[model samples]
Target: MTGPDSHRLVRSPGVGSVVIGPAADGSRRPDLVVAADDAIDWTVFDGLTVPAGYPWPRIIVYEGDDTGFFDWARRRPIGTFEWRPSSAHVVDATGANINRLWIGLRTAPLHLTVPSMPHGVLTVNGDLSLLTAVLADGGACPAVDFQPDTLPAADAVPLRLPDLPAFAGAQHVTVTVRPLRQAFDCASLLQFPDTRHLSLGGQLVNVAALAQLRHLRGLQLRFCPDLTGLPALDSWPELTHLIAFNVEEATGKRLRGELRRPGREWERSGVSQLRRPEWFATEYGLPFSGWPAAKAKKATTAYRTAQRAIATATGPDGVEAAIRAFVAVVNAMPGIETTEREDAGDAVAQLAEDTPFGDLTEDAQDWFDDARDF
Candidate 1:
């Protein structure tokens, strides 16, 4: 069997500098090293097989020709593999071999594939049709974090139900297409009613169509700058966790009201999970001053008034009154960012539901505690 120290001479015209070495971590396994040379075709793996007792290399150091390198890597067994595409133009071949690769590696959950391009920005510059083909192949994976390099062109068609069977059983799906100049509708996701968690990010104008995903237990909307409105949540009976970031003020207030009201079954099941936008602003080093003392006092006063109202009122009328009071408190606090207001809204919603304060699971509770300080 070929060991890590074993040397093999692969001679191709104008390719005399290829060097395979031990794993960078100083492991015993060898590293498959390939450099960009037009004379070298990466498809050489088509006729080669892994030698017994010498597993496929876990690390690949390819300095050139990303397109050809990925084409070769796609055919190999998908184990614990890492790639260092040192070239400036690395193109992931997932679109071409996702079906075969995903099927063979279904047992081991793979990290979600993000676009790897010359620029660091998450943008798609190549053929958008490849995405449609890859998803339509119906290879099951647990979770997918898909971010297109760019918005689909005017002539591009929307992805439909039949094209997304691969995600039918997925537990989580996160799609971010931010700063979109044109409208891109993802209403076709309504076909996958089994999807329990849905996260949509970007500048897509409206996500009202997503309300059709009735099976969702958790929903996250992030940095959707143009999303100024939302439809009624009466359709999403199973929804328990709701999160939003960087949404319009009016929309945030309206959602707070809807989440606090008591008669709605969905409203009673869970609370809104909001993160203060100011936290992000501070973390990202945006210009912001601390909240004024007067504004803080006013917000505290509103919160106390709402607590009293909830204590005194009874039935649906009391619930409505308490919700109004909570919204007033949140609106009065200008210092709190949109996300913080959502978190506060969730706290009040839990109170209205007669649930214990800070009743979230350990992980969630920890997140909230951390968010409070951030």
Candidate 2:
């Protein structure tokens, strides 16, 4: 008898043939990724046999019309359904990839829906029409990320949020990146019904409107220049992780919630896990903008300079020195506080994220803590 640690094939990412390999994490048979690189018909898998008790494939459609792909994938439990382009993937559950899936980034304008699919991330980047179609198809993911690729010209109408899905399921919702100009009220948010984590960007106009979301466990505010002050943290019973940096002394670090970097441009929350603080600011709200002309210019110059250094590092090993330099800059700043310290640390994490240096996760948080004193 074989030991339980023996490897098994989990998924196959082949076309015209079935290519198998050992499961890196240890399964029963050889493992493979099921998503094909090219847009192929579902019939391609007809010849790929599975053991009687093994599960069917969970395919990822990277390009082309998914009408046919949906017809086939929806047949099974739809274990993990994703219509992401090579770019449109969202794996932002902080670090959990077991019951949930990590969806990718999609730059193209396409709408796809697989009804009654299991929990995953839904990210729409081109138009609200895409969002509309997916909801219409009865598709639902626990997390919904809505970002329109571009804004209409000043003379044109801005994109608007589509009506909420008829059923309730979303647990984490992010309406950010590229502002929505159609004038959104919080009522559009109330429709989610089950959202425990909510993130909003430049379009935020009022904070009081969130009073009704008593179930919220976390909230993230990004670039809300028009934001009214936040409500008292204690008012809500379930809210935990909120804003990271405090601009107003009224809240200080006394906020009842901890801070977390909201999901990023390509890496939703995190594909693996959010181990420690990756505290990069999404730029300032009102306080930094109101600084004296020279002071504001200096801050921008400092940040941009640090960014250039980080990106131009000789290699992965050099990123540490570059990040350490950034910490020096933050520590040397005038009136250094939690906000400034977080900004410096976050800038490194956010910028290094996609680079080879980012994989050096164990060293990052410690670098910030070791070099800087708040």
Q: Which predicted model would earn the best TM-score? A: 2
* Candidate 2 residue lDDT tens string, 75-109: 43333434444433222122222232223334444
Residue 252, candidate 2: Cα error in Å is 6.6
- Per-residue lDDT tens digits of candidate 1, residues 1-374? 13344345554433322333333321223235333332345444344434453323332333233344445555543222233222233233453332112111111122234322121112211232343222323334445545544432323443322344444555566666533223446675664667787877654543777766767887777655455546656567877777776654456666778777787554223223343444332221111112355654564455557557656765445645555655555554444643354445444543454423322233333333333421
> How many clashes (backbone N, Cα, C below 3 Å) per candidate?
6, 26
Query: After best superposition, candidate 1 residue 279: deviation in angstroms?
Result: 15
- On a 0 to 1 TM-score scale, where does candidate 1 land against the true structure? 0.40
- Badly placed stretches (over 4 Å) of model 2 are 1-39, 45-61, 75-114, 133-142, 150-160, 165-169, 178-187, 201-203, 222-227, 240-374
Candidate 2 has its poorest 10 consecutive residues by lDDT at 270-279
lDDT of each: 0.45, 0.47
